[model samples]
Target: MKDFDLVIRNGTIVTSSDIFSGDIGIKRGEIKELGRNLSERAEDVYDAKGKYIFPGGIDAHTHLDMPFGGTFSSDDFNTGTKAAAIGGTTTIVDFAVQPQGKTLNETIEMWREKADGNACIDYGLHLAITQMNDKTREEIPQVIRDGYSSFKVFMIYEGMMVDDLTFMEVLDIASENNGLISVHAENPFVIDYFTKKLLESGKTAPKYHEISRPAYCEGEATNRAISLAKMTNAPLYVVHCSCEESASEIKKAREEGFPIMGETCPQYLLLSRDNYEEEGFNGAKYVMSPPLRDKKNWNYLWKALNDGVLQTVATDHCPFFMKQKRMGLDDFTKIPNGAPGIELRMALMYSYGVDKGNISIEKFVQLTSTNVAKIFGLYPKKGSIVVGGDADLMIFDPEKKVKISKDILHENVDYTPYEELELKGYPVATFSRGELIAEDGEYIGSENRGEFIKRSGPKII
Candidate 1:
């Protein structure tokens, strides 16, 4: 009998904490051993000379197949998860929105129907609570017990925004029941006031999207959310934080011993408000919630990531075709609010953040993979490469260079926001549970192999 199902030889193993030159042995979809040399037989062997072996990425924020702005996101689970694998992410926790009159159970079933036989990689769901009633209240604990351990509440948006009372109740119940709450930290009133003023003044351009939603909108709501989390003694995760004002608030709250964490995306850290100035209706492609901020906020977010103030980096991967984005041609408000980055997160972090000296390689791993898994309760199983952990791995080529464009990606979208961005490092191969699903940006995986992960409570690391 073979000593292992497969053995990867001669790679530099890297985790959030350490790096060493060794080999990884895999059997039965789990890591069986980690050591230098094994002369024992194996069914397959991969020589990964001069490569870096790191745990597969876990994107904690994504909107695959989700509905927003009157249309469905273009990248459904079938394409989205495969694109994520090509980019080195093996798992994703996507939001399942509860409609105005739907129960949490019904919402989960709807999302399950969308992903059941489509996904090519593992995934989990976070319920986006749109209504709060006595029945919903009673179901919260049961949902947590059933392994749906994180809930989402929107602080903005017209129909999805929860009142302060509902937010407080959700926080209280989530904290009491060991679930965590994530919020879209932007004040709706502020957005409404500025947007109405801009449109009334004949400023209905894509540039006005950023003007209507200023940095302070995010700042004010982030502060309020942190205060609410403190009052309820619960952990709060601020998603897609885009400005220095919000980062400062999160930093101060964390320093004061609050269980507050924030996530920032590459568009916020690399792209800027200037993207909204692309000629004509072309600028609609860059329109997203908490619109990209001034370039000055970039370094501040990078510093926050390095200093532990911002603990995670996620791609709010909600893609839409250019035709869908053009619905706002006459009015910017009709533009869909998202961009595609699920296939670019790893390369961007590796090239810009690590190679550019903004963050260390270990810090890169923590921000992109390890910290995400820990906060979402998949720590040792999904984030690390220790013995007995899932064989989710990425073999990276530190010196390889790639020029990114929509044509080169697997996401089911018409445009790429990071078009023409050059990168010095990229994933050469990706493995999910011992299966080589993607190699060199080409997918080799089967559909519906993904299992819905039943996660435990938030680990708070």
Candidate 2:
């Protein structure tokens, strides 16, 4: 019999802390040992020559088959998770929306049922609060106890936005329950008024989409959300933050020692408002909430990430086909408020951030995997490669080049906003729980391999 279950030999191991050349030995589904040439034999061995082995990516934000506008996103749990695995991600935390008037438990159960047998990697849920009341606020402690420690409260979306009173109440309860609150920071009322005026003036094209939801709307909401978090003494995470104004708001709060965090997506860092001005209805493909800002804001976002104002990078991978995007041809407000991005998030960030000298490789690991795991309470068990940690790893090839095209991606969406963009660096192999799920640009995992990760209480460290 082999002394070890498997051995990954002679690779540069990169973690959030350090980089070293060594071999990782696995037993069952956990990392049994990591060092140079251990005195052990294995049933299988992989020669990882000239590659970087890192912990599998954990995408903190994604939307699978989310219902928006008049149609649902094309990719469900199975296809989306498959795309994630191929891209070197082994875990995802998707939103479980509590529709207006529905109980949080019911919404969670519905989302759980949807992902039961369709996922290909480990998964978790973030509850989206659509309606906040005394009962909903009271349920925070129970939900926290039930292992959903993070909740998303929107500042935009007409039917879903919460008022100041409701927001304060929810924050108070979350604080008491040791939970973190993520805000979709955009002023819905301001956008609503502007949208009506723009449409009334015959500005119905996709270009008008960005014009309706200006940066100031996002800035104002960011400031308000930060104030609410301060008032309640609760930790806050601003999702998909765009523009310098919003980053400044978060920075100011952090400087004051508030527990405020920020996350930005690949779209805001790579794509810009120019994409919304494409000819005809093509611009609709890039239309998402708090739409991409001008080129100048990209530098500010990088600064925020470098300065520790922004803590995580996520995909917000919501999708709609080109045909579905046209649902709002006569009214930009009717278009779905999302874009397809699961497969391209990590590559785009690695190419632009790390390759361009904007961030260090260690920082990349933190923003992409470690911080996410820590915030959601998955820490050493799921985000690191130390002894006794889960053996979820990826073999990264820095020399590999890829050109973006929706036709080749696993997402069911019809078009991708980054279609012609070329990227360097890609993941050649991905493993989840010691099982090889993707290799050589192909996915090999079967459905239902994913298990729900129920969060425990707050971190003791």
Candidate 3:
């Protein structure tokens, strides 16, 4: 019999703290050992001669089968998780929305039903709060104790935005329970007024999407959310931060030693407002909230990530087909809000953020995998390649070049904004829990291997 289940030999192991040449041995589903050279028999062996072995990525922000303006996003848990695995991400923490008038518990149960048996990798959820009441607040502590420790409250979105009192109530509940609260920080009132005015003036093109949700709206809400977090002494994470204005707000809050974290999506780093001007209604494909801003904002976002003001890079991977994007052809308000990106997040971030020298390789590990696990309460076990941890690994080739095309992507969405964009790096192999699920752009794993992961409490780093 083999001494181990699997062994990856002669590889450059990269972790958040160190990079060394070693062989990693796996037994069952956990990493069994790592050393310079070990004479151990194994059922299987991969000679990763010159490749880099890193922990499989963790995408902390994604919207699989999310309901949005008039329709639902295209990818369900099965398709979304498959794409994530092919992209070298072994885990994802998607959102569970508390629909209006419903209790948080009800929403969580509903979300669990949607994700059960459809995932190919491990998954967790962050509760998105749209309703805050005595019952909801009372349930918060119990939910935290039950392994759902993070909740997201929005400052924008009509009918979804919470009032100041409710926001404060949520903050208090989270603070008391040691739960992290994430915010979609944009002033909905401002956006509503601006969007109404823009519609009145006959500005309904995709470009108007950006015009309606200005950067100032994001900055204003970011600043307010930071203030609320400071007052309640709760940790806050701003999701999908887009502009320099909002980045500055996070930087200021962090400078004061506040427990504030921020994350920016891949669209904000690679796409720009110009993408909204694509000929015809094609631009509607990029119409996510906190719309992609001017190219100059990229520098500020990178700086935030490098300086640690922004701690994670996630794909708000809400995908919709091109035909669905046309739902708002005459009126931009009716268009669904999201874009497909989970499969491209790590590659694009690595190519643009690390390969370009904006951040070091270690930082890439932190932003893409480590910090996400740390924030969502699944660290050391899922995010790193340490002994006794889940054997999730990826073999990456930094020099390989490939061009992104929507036709070849696995997202159920019919189009990709990054189509034809040249990228210099790609993952050659991906493993989740000691099983090889992807190799050289081909999927090779059993379906429904994923399990629903519950947040057990605040991450024990």
Model 3, C-alpha of 316: deviation from truth (Å): 0.3
Sort the candidates on lDDT, descending order.
1, 3, 2
List per-prediction Cα lDDT, in the order shown. 0.91, 0.86, 0.88
Model 3: per-residue Cα lDDT over 183-260, one tens digit each:
999888888898999999999998898998889999999999989989998888899999899989989988888888
Number of the top candidate by lDDT? 1
Number of the top-ranking candidate, with TM-score as the measure = 1
Question: What is the model-wide C-alpha lDDT for candidate 3?
Answer: 0.88
- Residue pairs that clash (backbone atoms under 3 angstroms), model 2: none
**Model 1 lDDT tens row, 1-461:** 88789898899999998999988899998999999785365688888899999899999999998888899899999999999999999999999989998999999999999988898999989999988999899999999998899999999887899988899999999889999999998989999999899999999888899999899989999999999999999999999989899999999998899989889999998999898888878788899998988999998999999999999999999999999988788788989899999988998999999899999989988999899988888878898889999999999999998888889999999989899989999999999999999998898987678889988888775
Residue 110, model 1: lDDT of 97
* Pairs clashing within candidate 3: 147-455
| TM values, all candidates | 0.99, 0.97, 0.98
Residue 304 in model 1: shift from native, Å? 0.2
Which lDDT tens digits does candidate 2 get at residues 45-104?
887889889898999899997877657888899989999998889999999888878889
TM-score of model 2 (CA atoms): 0.97
The lDDT, on a scale of 0 to 1, for candidate 2 is: 0.86
